[model samples]
Structures are given as C-alpha cells and as structure tokens.
Target: MINWYPGHMAKAKEKLKENLKVVDVVIELLDARIPFSSRNPKFDSLIGDKKKVIVLNKMDLADKKITDIWVKRLSEEAPTVAINSLNGQRINLMISKVKNLMSDKLNQLKRQGRRKKPIRLMIIGVPNVGKSQLINQLCEYGSVKTGNKPGVTRGQQWIKMRKDLELLDTPGILWPRIDDEEISFKLAATGAVKEELYDSELVGYKLLKVLKDIISDTLEEQFDLSQVNNDTLELMEDIGRRRGCLMSGGKIDRERTGNIILNEFKSGKLGRISLEISSN
Candidate 1:
C-alpha cells in the first residue's frame, strides 16, 4: 500500500539506461541492514550483461553474521563486498573486486594494442544507501552531495576517482510501484522511502514487531524494558513513556514516540541490527 515514485525518479531511470551504454562496470550499492529491500528489482533488466560489483554499504551498522551470509549468497551472482563507506572499511576489497571484474575486458583491449582507458563505473542504488558516501570514500574527499534522508541526489554527474577510474553517480531510483507491503515497511523502516510518504507511527509499530521477533533482548535492553510486551502498541507506549514523549493529559504522544524509535534504529542506537537475512 505504501508507494512513492517521484517524477524525477522516472527521468533518472531513463538517464541511467542511457548512461549504461558508456560504462564498463556497474557498482550496485545496497544497505547492509536491509539488502533485500534496498535492491531496486528493476536492476536485473536495467543492467543486463554488464559487469557488476555489489557493495554492501554501511556494514558498520549491520549484523556481521547476517551480512556475511548475504555476501556469500550474493557473490554467486556477482562480486560482492561489505564495506562501511563512512570510514572506508573494506573499501580496498571493493576496489579489488571491481578491477577483477574488468580484468578480462581490459586484457582484451590490451591485446588489440589499443590505448588504455579509465574504467567507467556507474554507481546505482536506492536513495540513502550510502552511494554518495561511498564515492566520497573512493575519492578520499567530499566529491558528491550526501544526506541521511532519501532522494538527496537528484541528478547524474561523473566523478574521477583516479587516473584509471571514472564513476557516474546517478540519483537513487525506486521502481514505479512497490506491491509488497512488508517490503514497503522494510524500506520505510530503513529510511529508503521518504518519511513524508508514510505514517511514522505505523512504521514504528511494524519495526517494533520485527525487532520483537529477531532481537527482543537487545530491544528490551536498549529501552530499559523489564520485558517485551507481546502487544506492539503497548510496547510502543511503554517506550514513549520511558522516553518522556508525554502529552498535556499524560497521554503518550504517538508521533513523537514513533519518530524516536525510528531515529534510534536508523542511527544504530538500537544496536547493530539487520531487518532482512539471506534465505540461504
């Protein structure tokens, strides 16, 4: 039921298709915490036959065991590496993977005695998946605009990482429609979809429900709860009361409480958590 496809995203997808004709390798960035939901399903067609290196950005905020499972599973499809773009963790490994994917093509060009060309890479992903931060780390400087919210990068621009590396940074684009409600909530919970498009209280409630199933102990400890109540609304209300999100009549302010839970989860204050895990 949650759907948000801005007009710009449509145009961005077209631009991405056009730009793909010139790039040699595609860098598909994904959130380490929500890898499955963060992936734009349209990519399988959009990037057909192109060499790809999947970089699981924000590994620092994801559960290591789950992330490792994802890395292994996704590697069968394409070269993948888990990295924290903010601090450049495992960035070298990603670079190595990218180079390895292009090795055959580069060698073929060399055999023809042609001039060497910089490897052109197009970085694509959903918004707020750390694409810009990953570029900044690659360039070792702030080469592109970045923010914690979705839809920050709106246009395409080329950034030269080195003499042999050129990157095309594009706006994060989502599919025209998201039919799966659970996927929609996961996207919202992980900050992929814009906050203005969904109800925060509903997302908070859904997120609490998921945490209760997978990380009840950590959630309880973080919020100082004696025990996690099975009723999600009651759990949220308890959190609201503990965090002092009270109204004039001592009622729990649902909106403020929801935002508190969401912000804490996004900021990793709830501890390293992964909402999605590899089925394998």
Candidate 2:
C-alpha cells in the first residue's frame, strides 16, 4: 500500500546531493513516536558520512521511556535531541547540539578566517514529521507553510533564519516501498503515509490490536467499555457506540469510529504511545 511517487524523491535526492556539498550539517527530523517507521531508509545512504544531528521532533506525544531508549540508541550514531517542534520546546538544545557537532568545522572556518558564512542546515524527514514546524521553532517565526498532512512544501526553497543558520526546505519524502508490512501499517497508522495509499479501516484495526496488547486497560478507561474485547472490530464497534459515531439505522459507522480511534491516538488522547521499540 506504500506509494513510491518517485518524482519528488528523485528530485529531492538530486537537490539534496547538490546542496549537501554546501551545508555544514543536516537536521534529520524523526517523529519521536515512530523513529524507525518515520525514518526514510534511503536517508542513511543518501547522507553518507555527513555531519547530522538527529532531532527527535514531537517528543511531547511520545512515551518518555521509549523516547529515552531511542535517544540512547540513535545518539550512538549521531547527536540526538528530543524536542517538541510545535511550541519550541527543547529547541535551544537542538541548536546547541548542532553547534557542538559542527564545532570542528566551525574551528576550521575560523582558522581560514571564514566565519562570516552562516552554518547551512537542511532539515529532512518523512512527511508530517514537523520539518516546517521545527523550522518555525528554530527561527522563532513562521517562515514556511505547514500542514498536518504530507507534502506541503512542494519544491526546494531556502530560508535564512538565524544569522548563523540557513535552511533548505523540501517536500517530505518517503521510500517508494516499505519492506516491512508492520512498518507500513505503523506509518499509515501514524499518518506518515498518505490516506489514499492504505485502507484506514485495516490500519485502524491493526492499531487497535496493538493497543489491545499494549494498552488495553487504557482503552477500557478511555472508552468506558465494561470490558475489553479480543475482537478488534468488536472493540471498534464498542468505541463507536460510546463516541456516538453512528450511521443511518443506528449502525456503527466503522469509518468514523476508526478515524476517531486513530485521531485519538495521534492526538495523545488515548495515551503517550511508542509503536517501535529498540531491538536492544
């Protein structure tokens, strides 16, 4: 169900490669909740040996313990900082980490008497991972348009933020296909993938199943169900009945119920959840 839509990917890769030569560091944004699923696999190969700071954006929505585990794992590879891009939380930490990571390069520039130039940074991430929102936080002002859905920034555009920083804004890109079915569902569940690419009912049902295993008690508490059910669809029906997502003839509107469940999960109304855990 993953749609490649390679035109943007190819263009992004080309533009990224061309710009990579000029940038001092790359701000690789990952959804704190789905660090594994939201990450573009090609990003590693595409950004080989480049100085990168992994900013785990939207940390506010993620489970703290799981996010801490992710930070520990990812920091082994690159400087990882957890942040909430929407309200500029921990943004300064990200800025400082970027500066710390680029210290050597900055020193080299100082040796050459060329500290006049800004540290060029390009923010890259999966769709809806808050690249634009992160940019706004960094600049402390709105510079790029942002949306909850994918592919808002359609072309390559550069924005000058801090006197010492310049950002290249590009449309969010995902791999044409995903190797793991679970990862695909996780991406679809987290709104990382386009709605049209996957069946919401299927993904929502899968989400409920996962929640049933991990946080069934929370579900029972949230939906006020007398008892949790093993059947995912039955649980959805129960939720629909509670949420009043009904159709004509008083039938459970599975579609709307599914959306409510997903939206609740996404909005953290259900609970702070982490879909992918560290293999370690």
TM-score of every candidate: 0.95, 0.93
Considering only N, C-alpha and C atoms within 3 Å, which residue pairs clash in candidate 2? 4-176
**Model 1 lDDT tens row, 60-88:** 88999999999999999999999999998
Number of backbone collisions per candidate, in order?
A: 0, 1
Error of 2 at 59 (Å): 0.7
Query: Which portions of model 1 miss their true places by more than 4 Å?
Result: 140-142
Report every candidate's CA lDDT: 0.88, 0.84
Model 1, position 79: C-alpha lDDT score: 94
1-280 in candidate 2: lDDT tens per residue? 5655658777887788788887778989998988988888888887888899998888888999999999999999999999998898988888899889778877888899974677788898988889888887767356777788788777787787874788877777788778788888888888886777777777888899889989989999999999899988899999999999888999998877878888899898888899888742
Q: What lDDT score goes with residue 84 in model 1?
A: 95
Highest lDDT: which candidate? 1
How does residue 98 of candidate 2 score in lDDT? 84
Measured with C-alpha atoms, the lDDT of residue 90 in candidate 2 is 89
